[model samples]
Target: MQGAQRNSLRLLQWMMAASLALPIALFVFASTISYTSTNDIADREIERTLDVAHEHALKVFETIDRSLAEINEVVRGLPDDAIRAREPALHQRLKRLTDSLPQLKSAWIFDADGRSLVNSLVSPPPEQGFADRDYFLAHVDHSIGTFIGTPLTPRPPYQGARFFGVSRRRDSDDGRFIGVIQASVLPEYFESFYARIGSDPGSFFAIGRTDGTVLAHFPRLDRDLRLDPTGPVGQKIAAHPDHGLMTIDWASDGIERRIGYRRVAEYPIYVSAGLETSAIRARWYATIGQHLVFGVPATALLFLLLAFAFRRTQHLQAEAAARREAEEALKHSQRLEALGQLTGGVAHDFNNLLTVIRASVDLLNRPQLTEERRQRYVTAIADAVARAAKLTSQLLAFARRQTLKPEVFDVGERIRSLHDMLATLLGSAIEIAIRLPAEPCLVNADAGQFETALINMATNARDAMQGKGRITFAVQVATTVPDTLTHLVGSHGFVSVAVSDTGIGIPAARLGRIFEPFFTTKQVGHGTGLGLSQVFGFARQSGGEVTVMSEVGQGSTFSLYLPRVPPDLLPQRQAPNTAPALAGSGMSVLVVEDNIELANFAADGLTELGYSITLVDNATDALAELVVDADRFDVVFSDVVMPGMTGLDLAHAIGDRGIGVPVVLTTGYSEALAQEGRLGFELVQKPYSIEELSQVLYRAARLRRVRDGAAE
Candidate 1:
């Protein structure tokens, strides 16, 4: 009788376990179906909304362009004087034309010189000229088809209107460029329409020129907003200029979105529509939540049954916990692997540079070397030093940790000066073109790093073109940085230096990783892959950004945007100094460095430059020496990183103790210097030439003397 009872209990326990498993398995199956179907429905809805936006953009732009074409034909053979003679009639005609089209805010006719001849907004249009405007300049230079320019606020007398130019080039009978005929397309029209159709929460709609300039957007961004050409939406347009779909984290609002984009047919414009991923996920959650409501009660009942078989349930729960822990450990291991890969690449390149230097040194040690042989070894060593210095600078720039010395200067002048240098760098096979606006574009940044960034980009262009295509450098003024550059969205304005190449374009798949350090597509030994990385870091560090646009077979354009400084901020230009190279005469320098070899090298170099040098191993010893006879040294030249208190600390200590000597800090790399900057002291970067060292020391020493003389 007891054995029978035991068998019955075992059967009941098995029945309970089966029941628990059955409900959980059914719940999992139901959830999988619900989640998949929910995502599908969301995707379809997003695509449907995108289709509507695309069609709306097409109709609006087509209507505007068609009207402009009709106006072009009306004044086809009329000269500027003839158009002016009939100004009243022409203005009335334009006003009527604009009134007929809800898309157009106004219309204007400009002469060859861009003087407003007739406008729909006002009769005998205001005495304003648009000669400097992008739309006018674009048509004046070339006979491109319909051109849609970036958004701009109308000047006085029409300042209330917000419009972008939709222009067509006017040509005379002889094909000479006459002037521009432009329609002032109201962005508000597009915005209103977008809002009506884009009713979903977190939906986005944008109309932009092919060049990534935002002409209009829904949810209304600043009028000056632009799009990053290297971002996901831009890449989609580049890869599929006609139409495409993409999933990306939208930088404008920091939302992940599923987007669809289409180009306005035969026009330099594109339109995009997107739905937020978060919103889509919410729908999925809602659908799944409904299932959970029913499944939860069933699950609770199953748990109660499992309590009768608590031993089996405990074993399963422990296994699940172990699985979770293993997953976490694996994720940590993967992160370490990624770190190791980056470090390994850095180590490899550094080792190669070091090997070259080591080999050159070993060869130079041979006794009684011939002049030719000795010169070759010395040249090799010099080459290695230069390459190493460049490598170090690139690394620092990529990390955005380089100490920058910023000054307000004209970027156009700098580019003009680099013509000869760029010519030499790109070689004879490549043709170079430069386009500079009449007005100077100025920015405050480290001029040397600016030049380096330009050179790096040009070099990349040259390589992409296989050393034989035209590279154009164009400088333009921009009112706002791209909104997709999340970090720089609120920047007041920017000056864009664009480098374009007629070379093999970058692949869309590769564009996202192009700025990562040591990520390269070039064959081994052909490139270091840090060129773009350096450009990226330098722009960000300088309060700006760099963006790229590339179509697989149609070449590429890389643009560097820097914070613009007004012309008023430019420092007065001083006459060039004609002083002799030995300019450090009579200045005494206290060299503070922990490394004996480096200290001796600097001391000897400064001494050769006509400066008297006193050497010390650390800041403490240098302070001791300075405390003894403060007037003995004109300047203290110190290495920033040292064994004890850093060089920066010493500079502070010197100032705190009333040491009148000026401190000039030097370093190859220092986190503190990069973060806090020069700290009111002169700074010279490492691997600097003797001439550079002399100039900095002399300037600091002379400044000190002048201050001391004033006190006396």
Candidate 2:
């Protein structure tokens, strides 16, 4: 009887071990399948989103091209004799052309002398000469059938309406040039398309110029919320054009977002869409939770039944628990990664604010400060600001929150400008030599921030040199080496800016963490430990890489590898024009601002500057005031972002009521308002001193005078 009992127990133990092992194995298999399926689905969804965005952008370009073609056909309809005579028949033909196309806001003919022969709209004669305009000059050589002009805000009197003109040379049957017929399209035509994109409530889309200026956005939010594409992420995109999607912690939104960006293949613009990753993961989490609720109980019951049958099941149970723990560890690692990104974002924003304050305080110390008492106050304020700036910089570097504005500039010129300052900044113990090409050795970088990065690197080099050593700075076009070859395949371009110092070189072990924030080798109070980190951030933000080469006794070299901007596509430099003076005395102005302090300050400043001011806190009150006496105010000075009604809506209202009062918009934010393209009014930026307000007022007054003179 004893032998039979032992045999039964042995059989049961074997059965129990198999029971526990089977379910755990199945659970692992299920999880693997789920993860793989989910990953594939996510990738497909991302691709689809990118494809849709690309299609939408292409449509916009096509529409603009078609409109230009239509304008060309209209210009060809004008008779050669009518063009030469500049007769009423020509005016009628232009009017008919504009009337037929709703998209064409206004059409006009300008003679070779820049005289407006005929205009679709009434009231103004050709007093302002267009001969000096870029469009006019561009047409002198390429007077083709349809020449598309660059985007520009039309001058005042037209209230700075943003329009791109399409000009065509009028020719006779003999193919001789007669005159030019131009059609101008209002910015509204392009803006209307953005509205139709149907934006998600929490998500926003922005189209920005290459320089970080926003062109358009859906569900218009605060202008201050506009993302600077020239910031760090933007530089990354420019440097690695093929990096289709990236997840970045965006400080403005206080969240990590999966950003999808694509450069418009045919234009100098970029389109980016961001979706909050947390929001996306929330749905995934809910789905997983439901699965686990069912999975956990079923899994537990199977294990419990197996334990009753088997005494040897403990070992198998341990293995299953280990696998689950490993999976949890992987999840925890992902969470930590996300946390690091969040910290970095916070640091970037804090640093930007600090930089602004530091620059402002520095400006206060200029000789422009005349009074001794005022200067003393400014100095005290500067001291406080400097301390605050230092604290924020430390926080930023620790969090890795530095964004950059990158541009292509001559490295030689950039260094020479700071030569004198560097000598003063560093003692005579350190010798600095700059070796640069005579011709412009251009590297894509932000001039201001690049200077700061260079200074930080130089300071580090000086410190390492122990107050006596030579530092050499060199600029050159990048060349590929076998071991250090970059992944920028098919590209024949790059620029390298290098700084080398004969100092105590970094040890091999410490070199890797040198770019990390708050990682310093110096004693306390000697450094904030942000110097190298700032250089790293600056390099990354400029869409480049920062690399270090060091040896114990041979010293160290730091190289910043940046992309090069093509020569033909470089930004054009336009000569500055003096601000025109106000042409009227005793002109009454209506000031609208939501901020009471700002409004009152503006009113006081304008009143002192010779204009009578009527101040209102909102657009509604301003409109009510206007209705009471529409003719009282000569111009409406309003803020764009307000509580009830926006400045643009107010301007539209005034236009509908036939109030010919000119509108002057004032805002601290320029991106959104600028994108609106000359809302038929002049715009002045906020935080303006009294002098700037006076100048803008003067310009508005002068514009009215010019318009009135033309009317007479």
Candidate 3:
């Protein structure tokens, strides 16, 4: 009986082991297969999304191109006499052109003299003259076929809204240039086109000029928004022009997104489409969850059977614990990634605000005033700008977008000059130490930004110590890492600057994210979460790297490794200077600006400087004024943005009208309008102080005078 009982016990144990082992092994195998299948599904979904985006983008480009091509064909076929006749036949032809292609808002022909010959939307005898339009001159070259023109406010004050023109040369039957034909498309056309590309509220599309000026966006967001792609993923997209997809936190919408971007390889413009990652990943989660639901019950059944036979629940429990740990880790990583995106978005907006403030302050300083009052205003402006400067420095540092203005400089000398400032910044509660090498170290970097970075790091160190601890900054040149320091050395040729502090060391959980933007332990108002990010950015931008070492009780050290600057390239030093005095003989000028206050100010300022001034509210009035005295004005000074006719069109009209006057274009936001090497005239960016205005006017007048003298 005892032998039989023992045999039964052994058989039961064997059965229990098999039950536990078989299902779990099967579950793992099934799970692995499921995961691989899910991965493949995700990849296919991404590719499909990309394809849809690419197709939509290409359609927009083709639509614009085809619309322009149709207008060009009509223009080439029409005779100058027929277009110039200003009869019902001409109006009918123009209307037919627009009717056939609804995308075209209006179409018109301009005679060689810059006068509107035939317009689709206007009465046959249209009163407007094109003698001063940029498009007229831009198309005159003929080499630039089917080009996009700057945004144009329509001609004749009460007639049209803002539109962009697509122009091609109008050639006679004999191939002689008789005139130019243009198709003006409204902003609504682009808005509608972008709208069709993406319907998801979370997905947005933007059509921007090459210089980053956004022309149109679907679900139009704020006009003030700017996109900077200097971050790791942004850099990758820019460097690789091929279509690609990635999950990134979009700072603009404050959402994690799986963005797919493709450069319109055929068009001069850059357009991109972005979709929310949540939307794309939601499907994957649902599918995975369904599988998990079915598998979990089966898994539980297997465990129960094993428990009944073998009494070994501990092994099963251990495996569950391990899976939970992995899931937690993945969630944490996702959170950090989200936080980095938020930081970048905040930084971009902050930088734009700083730019506006800085430009305003710079303008304020150019006028003459009483010494005491001027000194106060200057100091106040400087102080405010200094704070703004800190934000920009941090942005550049974190984004690695800081423009390098490198020159040879003695790093040691620069640091020594900041000793007094450091002492005040550190305060009496904190002890400070500096270790420098005996030899001078030269570095190539932007000095102002470099100084600001050092000060920021020092301030952070002071805060870490809670205003009462020791901080040491050591700078040295070493051939190799000493055996004493195995924990913080890397393989590279470097000059090291180590800032160590005896304060609360970073928690192990947060250590990995210490350099991420906006990952802060400080109270809301106390930090922007950009300090260390900026430090990391600056180091990388300066051809260096940063690393941190910390232990809970042992404190922490932040080390920056900067590559030594080559001897051939050193920093340049500049002496203080003032703007050169305006130098040119007085000449007649036309000032076209919509803002009454600004227009009056500009006209008065120009008149005071002894230049003859003609002022107008829009391109129509400017053309009328010029017709009255076409040869009187030496230059046309106009604002780029206006209610009816933009400054660019006004410039083109000036050229078209057979007036040889030069143009000095001005704008508050000229990025969208100004095309480098194509304007055929000068540009003065707005909110301009008297001095800048005078200088630009002077340059324009001088150039015109020289040209006239050559003609003589």
Pick by lDDT: which candidate is best? 1
Better of 1 and 2 by lDDT: 1
- Prediction 3 global C-alpha lDDT: 0.68
Predicted model with the maximum TM-score: 1
| Model 1 misplaced regions, further than 4 Å | 1-344, 484-492, 571-587, 607-612
Q: Each candidate's lDDT (Cα)?
A: 0.84, 0.65, 0.68
For model 2, the stretches where C-alpha displacement exceeds 4 angstroms are 1-374, 382-408, 443-445, 481-492, 507-530, 552-554, 568-712
| C-alpha TM-scores of all predictions | 0.51, 0.37, 0.35
Residue-level lDDT for 595 in candidate 2: 88
Candidate 1, 215-258: lDDT as tens digits: 87877876477678887767777787788778887666667887
Candidate 3's residue-wise lDDT over 1-712, tens digit each?
3455456556667766766677668767766676667555655654565566557656755765675566566556656675565456666877886786656778777777667777787676556677566667776656476666666667664265566676777676776677777777665665676577566545666555544445566666544344565764557667776656666776555677655566676665665666565665565566666766877687677757756644443454456568768988998998777766675657655666667567656756676756776666667665555556566557655776554445566666677788888988889888888888886666766576567667767777777788889988888764654343444444434577788988877888988898877777887567777788888887777767777888887778887766656545555774333365453356777888889999899877767767777788898898888888777777788887787778888888878878877788876444244223225557664446566777777877778789889989
**How does model 1 score by TM-score?**
0.51
Cα deviation of 505, candidate 1, in Å = 2.4
What stretches of model 3 exceed 4 Å from their correct place? 1-382, 478-493, 567-571, 577-712
